[model samples]
Target: MQTAADREAKLQRHRLRMTLLSVANTSLQSVIIGLYAWAGEVGWSVAWRFFLVGAGSSAMFALIIWRGLNLRLKDPGLLLPQIALSVLIQLLFLVLAPKLWVLFLVAVLVTYNFAMMSFSARQFTLAWLLVGAASALALFAARGRFGHFGTSGVSIAILWLFFFLCIRQLTAIGTQFSSLRTQLSEKNKQLSASLERIQELASHDDLTGALNRRSFMQLLADERARAQRAGQPFCIALLDIDHFKTVNDRFGHLIGDAVLKEFCAVAAASIRVTDRFARYGGEEFMLLLAPSTSSDVARVATERVRQALEAHDWDRIAPGLRVTLSAGVSQLAPDESVEQLVRRADEALYAAKDAGRNRTVVA
Candidate 1:
């Protein structure tokens, strides 16, 4: 089972990877900015300042996530804060280097595009509005100095190509994330099915599909407690297949297993829906009936199961094969404990076996 600590650790690891990816994105943007600075489109001092601030901010976020500090926040990914800071830095650089304003504008778009991968629709819309308002204010303040595509045609084309390539890369990353989410969803479904199968195996018999001995005992204990508390009476029946060893010795264990399965099916159909039935051990089964007024009711229910098995066609399985059951029924008494009640039922079962092979004895 996955505990809270394990889930938290997994989240931290994922967040760390995201932080590293953000840092790499910042480095890539810085590279482009450095290229512009080298070509004299933007001042070297302004380019270097932008690089320092952007990279420093990314590193700081990475450190916070790595140290498990972001767990304190509602959004542990720190996505909104990162987006806000990145946009503000780009806008600041836009003001500082208006000659390269177009590049910074593209950078702002790229940042929001990346945010789309993690942000909810509402968050994305809010971020978009805030960025739009901030961009308008910055443009108004630097309206007279805002640069256009006045550089050489080659330079303009190259910048345009670089921006397009960046957008394409972000699109690819989004696609990859979408695919991974789908795969994770499928894996979770398979995991749920596997867990359910494991639980069934733990509680039920593998061959007969009846409750295993351990699970049956647990149910018996619970029922006993409930019956005692409510001042009610329930009954237990210990049943054994008559001449089971002879059949197994004559026909082998495979046919013996088939007989066991078919007997359980008939017994289950004969009993009330609320009754519990289980395989106690080899060729021995136990039944816990719902609350009854007398041991006669319990005996009648057990007899129905015996008659059902006796009436079933055994020739289909093996020629001239026959099966019968002997059961012992014991009703809970006012002062009887679970172990004592089961012991009485067991003794009655032995009595029935001694008197005749195919019969039920009440105690």
Candidate 2:
């Protein structure tokens, strides 16, 4: 699970990267402005002013987001403010360097395009209206100074350079979107895997990988309902590892847990796939065998499990380790409740223990 702090930190890192990209964009524009100034098309002071204002605004936003100061805002990205400021700056430059109005106009469009990545449709519409109104006002105020495009070769070359930069910015945006898509896919897969693990933990024993008692009972009830409707027969067996406490005391709980796990594996392999196996409690297990009509069939199934465990190579686990199981098998009586059936099996299990530790008894 992602903690609040982790989510916040991730957001901060994303915002910081966006800020850096904004700064890089501003730097590119500043370079173009510097080039124009060097060619004597604009004053050096104008280039310096634009560079300082653009870079400083980006740095200010970065600091605010990084310091956790934007959390109170509904739109933590401050998309509107950034777009409004960028448009206003472009208009200012359009008025100051009217001969390069095309350059500044393109820059304003670039700003809107960048905003498209973060803005919702409604937000984008609102940003469009805001920029439209602000541009109208700024253009009106500088009506005489705003519309100049030279027919010189140098001007055409600069226009081509500006188009090339715009293409680069668009490509970068496409790459960012591609990266986000891949990340979303990976996160979705991780979420699915986490949900599967949660379901497994809820339904199965952590150590033996068999159904837990509660889940087993639920399945048993459902099975009983279906069986009663279809007039089918089924049997249940309660199994206990003989001398489990002694094994734990001599070899330690870890070894005891391993033995339990191995026993379940052997029992599962010995039983039919249609049967359901569960860990009833500590060192005790149960099996629900389906389509079984006779006590002889139930006893044979239980005996198979007992024989498999007894024949297992316990020497690989420990030099002197030996393991055995005793089981109690019970068939469903006519109209019998689940509780009664389980109780009868419990009694038979105790009887098996009382008689000899490594055998099966039927009820």
Candidate 3:
């Protein structure tokens, strides 16, 4: 795991790189204009030429900054046109700056970023090939006018190709690193989710699809803490299969499993969406109703859920063993913990068991 300091260091490095790129891009314009004047082929005022170079670069970099700041490559068809425009601006620099053919060389060198970034490797390679051939031909043409093959023109073209090739390699390496980082993050997320699911399965009953006793209490504790913090209320319902063991002994455990599943389904269907149901243990279950409620409201819901489960047909599952439920209901006491509320409900449940066992009891 990366510490906060490590992450901050990496972020600082990235910001520094972007800062360097933005500054270099803007500064190259003035450098090219200066080179042109140094070569003594211009009929233009030096100050005005420098001003235009600065102004043009400022506008173009501002535009690129606005577009590129929050962009991601995975977003399809997003920054392609912006990069193309950058290339165009660089080409325009080459065309306008007449004296400093070296500057034209630099402009071409710097702005061909699109070849590596916006296009595929094959496309970039092909474009570089064409430009290399074109540069050679242009050099051959300029041989009679300039200082022949020994002129700075030949060296300028070679350096331009070299710079572009270097930038391409750098871009490819960055792209690979970025791809690996994203894959690792996605893989970590998947691993985290899988572990959570495994923990849930271990702590929950398979038949009823509810939290077993341990997870139920843990969840109750969580809810209790939230309610205490907010100074609110929470309600719970404890339900049991009315004659689960009898059903198992008579119709077999498989049939009893079906009854347990059907009972949970019916109870789940009966409760509001805010209710959380969990298998407390064996044939017992618990529900955590959020946003609190009165004792009367809890009792009404519990009775309604019990009646719904009893009313549901078990014949399709067991054919002969009838399945029903007895539930004990409770509301959060003032400043009570999960243990206190559950104990009260558990007490009520056994009370229901003591008082002839096939009904709802309230705590």
Candidate 4:
């Protein structure tokens, strides 16, 4: 649902926040060093050297932030340059710390920042391993300056172990959340499909596979409304199978059912796909045609159904078996009610049956 503009705006806001954080962190470090220099706690030369390093690092980050401002033009996160810059920043911190043992804290901070990025677990693990190894090598190189391996050495090793455990725990939790999300998505899809199938069953007749009377009437109402608005003509036809009761009496209801289904299938093929067909009741049905007038177009559609039914191989149901339909087509008059139209069509159907069987009458 999110538009491209919305996503771009979100990325811009995130990049802005990252830029501000970088500025704030850099400024705080510079201020702290400046305070030490001003108070003479550290010599002005040493303080200035640290201040220069922080300022230079801040400038480098600012350059990256400048690139980030154009994030929409390119990727905004976890570029190789960004990763290298983060590593260089942590190395700067390691070099500036008074005690070599403090490298463990620097490693923890760097790992946390990397974990917050878009890296996969594999990438994070590989990067973290490299960082931890570098920290250990740096400590080993500085061991002579600090004399023997003491409590500080033990504390550094313990912190590294704790960091490793944290990473494993976080990875496990991430995997579980991913699995739960997939299951939830599949359940939502299945529920949606089930609801659709239920609706289809509710809307259609089981025997004829046509719209049920209720759904058909609803569709007719909609078509009527549309025709009224568009000043277009629409019509309905009521059809009945001739002597359907006799077929049931002579051949049993099973053969009668087969004849009804076959008649519907033939009529469906004869009508336009845009037309609506429905089983109105036993041996009765309705047809709705839109953008068409009653006498000519509607009559043609009914005639097609009548001809199709008469031509079909009804003898398959039983020897010498034959079936026919009587239909009445009525066009909508201006501002006519649905009941009035149906009643008129029903009257016409009765007239068709009275005059003769197997025929269509238009009203």
Q: Please give the ranking of all candidate structures by lDDT, highest first, separated by commas.
A: 1, 2, 4, 3
Off by over 4 Å in 4: 1-161
- Candidate 3, residue 295: the lDDT equals 74
User: Taking the candidates one at a time, how many backbone clashes does each contain?
Assistant: 0, 0, 1, 0
User: Candidate 4 lDDT (Cα, whole model)?
Assistant: 0.71
- By lDDT, is 2 or 4 better? 2
| Candidate lDDT (C-alpha), each | 0.86, 0.86, 0.66, 0.71
- lDDT (Cα, tens digit) per residue for candidate 2, span 1-363: 899999988987887788777778888888888877776678898888988998779878888888888888888886677777878898888887777777887888888887866888898888889888877776776777654545578766766777898888888888978988999999999999999999999999999999999999998898788889988888999999999999999999989988988888898899987888999999999999886456888898889989999999998777799999889999888899999989999999999999988999998
Candidate 3: tens digits of C-alpha lDDT, residues 1-363: 999978756654553354345445545545434444454444346424544654454455444445554334453232344344544444444444433455445545554553443477786777677566655654454454442122577446544644565465457547846876898999999999999989978887867777787877888888888888888777898888887788888988887787778787888899888778888778888888787666777788788887787677777775765767777888898777678888898889888989987798888
| Cα RMSD, each candidate | 8.8, 4.1, 15.8, 17.2
Better of 1 and 3 by TM-score: 1
TM-score of each: 0.63, 0.78, 0.53, 0.57
Q: What local lDDT does model 4 show for residue 354?
A: 97
Estimate the lDDT of model 2: 0.86
From the highest TM-score down, the ranking of the candidates is: 2, 1, 4, 3
* Model 1 regions lying over 4 Å from their true place: 1-98, 101-170
